[model samples]
Target: MFETMALMPQNFSLPDAIWRLLISTGLLLLAIVILRTLTARFIRRHVTSSELRGRLLMNFRNGFLLLGLLGLALIWGDQIRSLALSIVAIAVAFVVATKELILCVSGAILKSGAGSFNLGDRIQVKDFRGDVIDQTLLATTVLEVGPGKTSHQRTGRMIVIPNALFLSEPVINESFTDHWDFHVFTVPFKREDDWHTAQKALLAAANRHCKPYLESVRTYMTKVGVSRGLEVPSVDPRVTIQVPVASEIHLTVRLPAKPRQRSYIEQAILSEVFADTDYSTEKP
Candidate 1:
């Protein structure tokens, strides 16, 4: 029987080809499942870092898919050369179609490995400023915070930003180190007003409101300075006067503040300054 079959024609009918294709597909799926189970078990046993595990799992998935394709090609026999060419063409097409998506994914991987920012960090990218709520391979989701007239309050909007933007634009991670951030606001006064009293009052308000952050900010700044060789400026509340207009005096108050509490601190300072009869008195 074996000799007779070998001597017979090599041509296969449509039904036979279809049946073989189905059988190959089923075997490929079973192999994929088994390989995935073994790979996962090995990775779980060996991989300690969560990030590394995720990366390894992704690589395993890709490898398994390639292996499955190769197995199918082998099972199909005579179509091996055409199968390889088709695989290359498919891969090229996929890359071309998902170029930006691939870049975004790469950016996410780089960002994660570099530890640039993490979930719950308040970051500003271009015109968007919000707390990062979610991170995926292609995009980062941020809970939208105030942009106009709202300060740090959430605006009930979710912004999905492509991770690729991290490679292209600078990210201002306000919550990168801690909950403290440098806050600065300008207060305008009439030139004839008691500018000196106003300045002292503003400084006092800043000190009062920002006292809690002083020690932590100093420690953080000191570490940053020592490690980066950057100057560790004073964390004490500072007041600088600017005369942008002839008849007006601008007092810029710089202090450490929790990003979310900036607006409240500013309000408190303004109220304190305004309520002071000494500073509010005209220069008559």
Candidate 2:
């Protein structure tokens, strides 16, 4: 008898299971609606206060809705679980297929949220430094800025960097000044050279070139300090001495100049200082 029963096919069918769930859900909803309607009518007839009756009806409806939802969830639990599993599988496939594109979009979002830089702003990312010419969700277009960092000259080549790089790398915004800002350069001299005289000569050249913008830069820096709630360092031209290696001494010179004229000002100061001060021991 057990073998005969086993040989008979079991009556489980997907269509039947779905139909059963649908029917149970429909019946449960019908029961709740009928109960709510009958109870609401009873409350309206028995309750004298309109506001209290209205509140009771609302509470009953909300309570019945909750019960209906719970009953439906119970009726559909197995199918809902299967549907959720399928959805999860689809989501995993979608993510795997579009990983890079997703990262690029996410990077674009990060850039917008951080407000890191804008068009015409000079920015450096890892080894790439350039002026941002265009931006999109997938990539950023930049006009290359350097044969070297201090060159401040464009290479006339456009580089399209994947926005995804912004996620992993830090962006350096070099265009910190709107009108005026500090510019720094280095002049290397022999350790045996007249260091004091060299310092005086570089300072003189810097002061001569930077004198006109001193007051304006100071005013701008003062406003920046006030807005940022910090004391800004002096914008006046200054030179500091650094001995990095045994053979050479470096004089670090800082001066205030417009952002667009940093290279020009630096070259001018360097030319003048070199002309006036001789670092070489040999007579030229």
Candidate 3:
């Protein structure tokens, strides 16, 4: 339909310009369709570094397509004198369509390169922390790894968090500072309970698996903290128990660990308590 608008020269015929505009528009659409499908397929099939690169490329391609469309828009402008204005209008469209994406990509690169969260780290990016499975420019994807694991597991769903969180929001990398964060589970016992004995058994289990790693982590934590002028973070194992609830006392243990290992350690300690605790005593 567009003729004079498609050409730089006024002498161009209406039919010739229309043909050129349609031809260019057709090619643009074809590229868009092909690139969308191919890139989606590649990202789906890959993981880790390779997948990250592919998604990053896909984000760049989106910007490129916006430029291509602007090219066509200019080619079909109503008046040759309005060429600069058409270009400016198209530039705004490019920003509107791609600004957020560009921000996300920028944040993703900063975070990934800084080693913010490695695969399997328990990180809550904008409140979606679990075990990180894959991180890409567009999203930080994780498999929820807790009591919620089984419930969400049936659906085989992965949590996809926008990477822009690295820029604007606080990231709670549970794996970075604490390998483990614990919740207390309490079953009531008599006031005359051997709580110390019960607590020991739980601590013993944790010490067995968690103690050896302490020697190495202690030095690392201390050196890193001191260099950064941070308090030499306590590396010794810790256990806190409280009897705030009637008939039950709650015990909690926390240890430094890799993010991926939190669930396993929790299960281990719980199994130890279930096996060793005596039921006759009632907590008051």
Cα TM-score per model: 0.60, 0.82, 0.52
| TM-score of candidate 2 against the unseen true structure | 0.82
Q: What TM-score does candidate 1 get on C-alpha atoms? A: 0.60
Computed on alpha carbons, the lDDT of every model, listed in order, comes to 0.85, 0.89, 0.68
Candidate 1 residue lDDT tens string, 64-153 = 989887787777766777778999999999999999999899889888988888888888889888899999999999998886533677
Q: Model 3: clashing residue pairs? A: 179-257, 188-247, 189-282, 189-283, 190-282, 190-283, 247-283
Full candidate order by TM-score, most accurate first = 2, 1, 3
**Residues 115-180 of candidate 2: C-alpha lDDT, one tens digit per residue:** 999898889998899999999999999999888776788899999989999999999998886788
Flag clash pairs in model 1: none
- For all the candidates, what are their Cα RMSDs to the real structure? 15.3, 7.2, 19.5
Q: Name the regions of candidate 2 deviating beyond 4 angstroms.
A: 1-14, 37-53, 194-196, 275-278, 282-284
RMSD (CA, angstroms), candidate 2: 7.2
Candidate 3, 64-151: lDDT as tens digits: 6786778667767654557778899999999899988988899899897787878766666554657688878888888764444221
